[model samples]
Target: MNRTNKLSVIGIAVFTGVAIMGDAMLSIVLPIYWSDMGLTAVWQVGVLLSINRFVRLPINPLVGFFYRHYSLRLGISIAMGLAIVSTFSYGIFSQFSILVMMRIVWGIAWSLLRLGGFLSIIQLTSKTDRGQFIGLYNGVWGIGSLIGMLVGGLLIAETSIRFITTLFGLIGCVTFPFVPFLTPSGKKEPTVQKTTTDQQKPLLALDQFVLTLSTSMVMGLLIFGVFSNTLSARIDQSYQDNWTFMSFAFTSTAIAGIIQAVRWGWAPFLAPFIGKYLDHTKHKQQALICFLLSLSALFALIGSINQISFVIVLLLLFQFVSTGFVTTTDTIASDLAEKGDSIKVITFHTIMVDTGAALGPLLAFGLLEYFPLRVVYLIASILLFVLAIGWISWLRKKQNDPFAFSVRK
Candidate 1:
């Protein structure tokens, strides 16, 4: 990538990191501090947490439409503004209705930032290094997750919710001056252009998008949707909030926060390397299969293990598999988008990913109501194994036809 493109990618990643810290912190703080936030009902906590996602289900397509006509710079600016308002009010608002409205605003802000970020990468990066750049972008922005989970989760015990949310909101204000410098100013031109040979090749069957889009949804369902939402409870089941290290007592929530923080902390270095490998590898399908199978086994191992130390180690390894799952699956989506109408394809890809994420917790929680957590994880493992088997079939078919138009550029 050129210097300007590189700078833009880094700047937007930084901006997104800040924008997400407020949302990320809520995953850790909201349920525990609902009363502190003036919430009177327990069920209301789930509404507050999930309402943003429901709003995004309808808003992503609109944001995609917005990018087609408007500048990413403008979209990101508006998103940041909404994020600031919502995050700041998290500390100030006590009324449930007003809080829900702010959550809805945050939902819209997230859609803009997400689509805007991916659109920026699609605009700025060429095919040769697209994976690496997008991978790095994911890693850099994850710093906000690290901060949100680590600092915010740990600090809730020492400070007030209002203090934490307000502090994060103010930190977002510091990035206002840098927004325009990072995002592209003009509307997006078409990024997909088939080569002469590619033009001659028949397009991949099933709309050329179904495979990757479906895969993206499943991975998101497992990683962002299920694992993230249920991590604290999983730790609690294993450690019972009594695990200690080096004479320091740790609550399950604290342990869960630290574990998630550790993942994000390593993501900046780890995700980029994974992306760079995917960029260079010629056998991308094989790589995807390996990632899926690895995840399947890890899920099984996590479900069966009862030793807290071993489970923590297994969970950490599961994190590695998950990071690879998301990076690999998303890079496939980006690659596929580059082969067609970039915005429309990516918009659908985003929706599918959001769908998986949205459904994961509901499904997991509902199942948890009847089955053990191990049963839930094993079910996920079985789904992943089936996905891997399906991909193996796809690889064989692709080998039989050299000219079949696959999603990759």
Candidate 2:
């Protein structure tokens, strides 16, 4: 690899680590902060968590534009700077509105760093290693999440949320100087003249982009939105304690991250094989397989609610495998990106993921409020089935042309 490649990879990993750490810290500490401030409703907590992502739905595309037209590094720098300022202020301002505003600001910062880092990685590496590299990219965030939760847990056990937030803010600030190192220094390849087929008709490009994003949205909704949100709530109910719920959630999340990291190193070797088949095979069938297996996790969760130890263990196992597919599918979206708009493609992916994250709590809460827990799982399962049908139809249409990406250069 060239110097630029090495520096960009390292810098991207560091920033990813920081973002995950920040995320992990907020997961554990923010609930505590909310409770201490006399805010103690599941809906309120859900709002606190989900609103950050909801705001990102709009700002995420803008981050993509900045990355595409301007410097990814500059956008990342501004984002990190905002994160530092906003997180530090959390220590001094304890009001609900101020805290929500800080989270909104943090969401924008997260988009910049994450979207930029993903684009940077795509630029720095070749298509052959995309899965392994993307896995590595996500793995870095996993490690960051692990360390953040470990440290945040320790601090909250001994100290205060304010101190933890301040400490994390300092960590965010430290990453600013590293942003300059993330530039892609390699030259772009000389253009090859296009055949008629190479030049797609006008609306086709936009349609493909939207389809890729819709696939991303479905995947994100299942993984981040439904599973994460409902599972957390289920664990909380079983344990009847916030700390216990967080403990299990963080541990499981950390473990999932580690497994994903390890998979990153190995998955690329299989990527070529998978890509060949994935393009021709029934994606919807595979998607159905993914969902069916994922729903089995709800069984484990239901068992956990009944105080079955082995069932909770099974739940974590399901999470591990599900996340592996999630990571792999993410790389698939990268593969499907418009030729030159890799950043925008990935940004749309993130937005879809964030949208799922935002919707998880809302959907879960709405279901829990109006229906039984098992019924909620059934509803989610039905949605997954619908997504599978969509996937199948999409794959059948694109079977002859898997590398269907199209965009203006």
Candidate with best lDDT: 1
Clashing pairs in 1: none
User: Per-candidate TM vs. native?
Assistant: 0.94, 0.76
Maximum-TM-score candidate: 1
lDDT of 2 at 103: 78
Off by over 4 Å in 2: 1-7, 35-45, 185-195, 198-211, 236-307, 338-340, 400-409
| lDDT by residue for model 1 (1-409), tens | 8999999999999999999999889877888888988899999999988899888889999999998889999999999999999999999989999999999999999899988899889889876787788889999999997888677777999998889999999989999789998889987765667677656545444424667877878976898888888888888888954667899889887777778888898888898888888888766667788888998998888888887888899889989878877888878888777777888888888888888888999999999999999998999999889988777666556556644424332
Candidate 2, pairs of clashing residues: none
Question: Model-by-model lDDT, in order?
Answer: 0.85, 0.63
Q: What is the lDDT of residue 257 in candidate 1?
A: 77
Cα error, residue 327 of model 1, in Å, equals 1.0
